[model samples]
Target chain A: MATISLGVFDWLVIASYFVFVLGIGYYLKRYTKSENDFFLAGRKNSAWVAGLAFLSANLGALELLGMTGNTFKYGMYVAHFYWIGAIPAMLFLGIYMMPFYYSSKIKSIPGYLKLRFGEKTRVLNGIAFAIMTLLVSGINLYAMALVLRTFLGWDWDVSMWVSALTVAVYVTMSGLMSAIFTEIIQFFLIWFGLFLVAILGIGEIGSITEIMNRLPESFNTLWSTSGDAARNGMEVTWPAIVLGLGFVLSFGYWTTDFLVVQRAFSARDLRAARMTPIIASFFKMAIPFIVILTGLTAIALSNDPGSGFSLLQDGGQVNYDSALPLLIARYYPTGLIGLGVTALLAGFMAGQAGNISAFNTVWTYDIYKSVINREASDSHLLWMGRVATLVGVLISIGTAYWAKSFPSIMDYMQAIFSWVNAPLFATMLLGMFVRWVTPNGAFWGLLAGMGSSFYMFLAVKFQWFEAKILTLSSVQSDMAVNFWRAWWAWLICFAVTILVSLVTKRQEEKDLVGLVKGLTEETLGREVPFLKRPEFFALLSLVALVILNILFW
Target chain B: MASEVREMKSIWFLVGLVLLVMGGLVLLAGVVELFSPSERQTVLADTHPGIWWGAVMLAAGSLFYFKNRK
Candidate 1:
């Protein structure tokens, strides 16, 4: 594609979005008068709002750029991240897991750890989470800034600073509410913009079948990628996708990640809170159409010479991340180009703000209040929350510079998940379900799991071991390697926790009742009126998921 | 439903209003591009994505805006 220039209209569209974000923060500032208000929006969000925020919070540049690039690189196998990887986990969180989380009334996942295990587990997880949140924020900041510089010919640092300052100001001013409010807007912008690309690209290509016909046979099938590494474009087999990504990594993210869970925590009531993830699942089921299809379209365009995409590098390798922007420039005219760019900016900002907001809450409630000042006033805590948001964004900016070392933003993120999330999820699963799992078991299990995952990560990335356990021949790509690492790490944590729990003292039954599954009765209490029942929503999402899998199979 | 709406603050109304305006501007732009003969070939081929997407946004924004209007 030729050097694309933005018109006055495009700048206006982006500027207006920024102004609207700042304006929302200013308007909501007064409502954030207390710690509860600042961190949880006083638990006032309705189901629809919370659900949108939940989906939007996760729909940042990671989904826009990272997933799109991965889809371009890996083909249909990348859709697993949304479908089998996310949908079931989201429903499980809503239908079964959220009651423990909501009823326990803890502010962060680490807070729940303190109640279930002890200070050791809580502090260890809390510090790790806080650091991880900052790293994730930095990854998002770096990814967005890089994409903007590539697409618009803007200075990288300038793009990074502008985004960081915009997110920081509103987030500091109105806290989580601002981040969420902006996220809802972003949700719309991103969908519309992505829809524009998908619809136009499909029109240009004639149909999904036509596009598939033009691409390699390996790129067309989702389940068929497993037979041989040489044949599978993704270098991942079905077992890896099902066991590694679908079971461990997916559940780890949707069920436990405090960044996304914070949206549900902000819901007005238990029903709405539970409904949040379910509603998000419905949207999650459709995301592949917007993201994955665009990547496929870019792949089709790149393979056909004289198609004007120009995404190929020196080694016959596609600059996979450039797929989204190249598509935008290819199809969109001047005015629609503005909307598309706004959508890109919206996704970037939403991701940054989501990370920062989650960082603030975890810092204030989990770390600062619990460790540094146990008896601080709510007002003082609220002040600390603002400070944490500022500090978090600054640290993220530094991390963004560090993040440049990674080959791709998505690879860095999946590696982090392997190290932190797999172990954390194992602990969460045992802690919430198995009442006999002692505090010592949970704490030590987490440490063992995280340590082992990190070691295996280094092993895989460096080809450190000749042993089959250390070397993965089934998976061909670094991304697939990360997935299998998470799987192994989770198993270690699960085993260690069970072994340690049997020898250690268990918690009192009274203390564990509402916090553990099967130990509590009707945790959700009343039925959710037929239409809003989680099962009904989950079933609908599941049906759609099955049909999508079949259609693409 | 009423109770749910009652809990909503003005910030949501602002959300709806912003979407309505943004969608309206985008829809107008799409309409202009549709009418302009010179821009037709250079734009998205045979697809008026802006108008269609703008209408969707208009509907979505209005739902958020008017649902809490009372």
Candidate 2:
């Protein structure tokens, strides 16, 4: 494996990125005077700003690299993650969920829980979310450092510390405002830096049709081979794809996860908030052109004997994650290589910033202000938000070092999401749509859902029971087990909430006015025409989604 | 008066500034490489992607910068 050495021009491009982000943070600091500004970017961003930031928060370098790598491994089936797995949930968030979330004026998702359920459920989710955010943030930091060290021969400790410190300074300066600003910039940098690889790869491969023809039958079609697990690279049937990834995991993360939803929370009004995820869906649908196409191009090149292209192998195993970096090394010269590296660096820092900002909000509003100091002033809480940003970054640094020691921690990311978001989605769904859902039911049902998901993960990992029992299939992939486990967890949470609510007392309808669906008054976009509504855009996104699936099928 | 006081530079303007600076540098490097090519040429060095891509960035950056420039 060759190391990617940065020349003077490359260094300049990278240095410019760092300067701009820090400068933006310094500039926004004065305007970030209020708690709302610190926590939610002043609630003043347009739909476009919030929308790109919303998508960019989740579009980390690890996702870029890993998805491209997974495409090389799983073929077109990996597109399920971006398409059926994400777009539907995003549209659902904009169309059905944003009204409740935005209208409540809650600082965080946990704040909404406190209003709808009780203090117990809110605190439980707050604590869980805070832990999950730090762990994921730290893991991202570790993975970023690892990628730099492996590909560029950079020192791991330096990579980790420098990137972490940079994120700390920017995020602590103006909190979510700086985070959103950097994320939107990162969005542009990624498209400019990485999309070129797809274009160049297409140039090398002659055409997308030629690239598709070079692949084995198992790797080409999206849904055609999904009927039987044996016929596809993913080794899972359509049911698992639809139920697990599309419904449970996608809805859970997109609608409920505060990291992305907080971007929408920053929008100036309910209409912009609703439009945030709707606009984001279009971009999210387009990302596969960068990742998936480049991956198929990698496969096409490797299959050609005269091309002399092969993935880097470690310990006799082919490293799929090497696909994107190796492609950059193949196509990009000096100046462009620097741009590509900076794009990856921007991604790592923005993702870390997103997590830390989300953590600070949840810790300050949901935990500190709610439980530690109930009558804290706005200015004081704002101060605590900055302090929490520092503490969160430090904890993430510790987590990164821990991940460095145990690299296997990266494999547990999907499991961690299942434990937290899967069950919480069920509770959120019931609590919002069903007015009869009691606070006690939400607390207990969430606890059971999280517990069951974790238990199932451990049961499969340790071989306490055969995984077939959970997956209900003789042949299974790690992804298959993950989807089925999430589905089961969500179902358990849904059922338990219903049963517990039957026996327990519910919140009064008057008290649940803005939080729950039936009790809340619907004030959709009456001033705007039907064509300009979020619903119309969501319908268009859905139609695009259907056409894409059918075309690929 | 209140509106004037509250006005701030949009995020797009900053995005444009960064792109313009970086794109200019890349284009500069590309032209230098064109006259005296680097010893270690990449797989498709004959195509000189840096020049074209840099020009594209410059064009896009200029559009964003001028449109949003207050």
The candidate maximizing lDDT is 2
* Candidate 2 lDDT tens digits, A200-299: 9988888899999999989999999988998999999999999999999999999999999999999999999999999999999999999999999999
Q: Summarize candidate 1's per-residue lDDT along A1-553 as a digit string, tens digits.
A: 4456876556667778888998888877876788888888778888888898999998886677777888888888888899999998999999888988988888888888998998889999988988888988898888887777777878999999998999999999989888888898888888876777888889888998898898887888877656676677778767778878998999998888999999999988888898999999988888888888898998898787877665635367667778888788778766677888888888888888998988898888788888899999989999999999999999999999988776455466788877888889999999888899999999889999999998987775677963246326734677677778889999999999999999988889888878888787784545547665777887888898899888878
Docking class of 1: acceptable
Using Cα atoms, each model's DockQ against the true complex is 0.37, 0.55
lDDT of each: 0.82, 0.92
Question: Where's the lowest-lDDT run of ten residues in candidate 2 chain A?
Answer: A518-527
Task: Give me the runs in candidate 1 sitting further than 4 Å from their true place.
Answer: A225-230, A312-317, A405-410, A466-475, A523-532, B1-12, B31-67
Cα error, residue A524 of model 2, in Å, equals 0.6
TM-score of 1: 0.94
TM-score of chain A of each: 0.96, 0.99
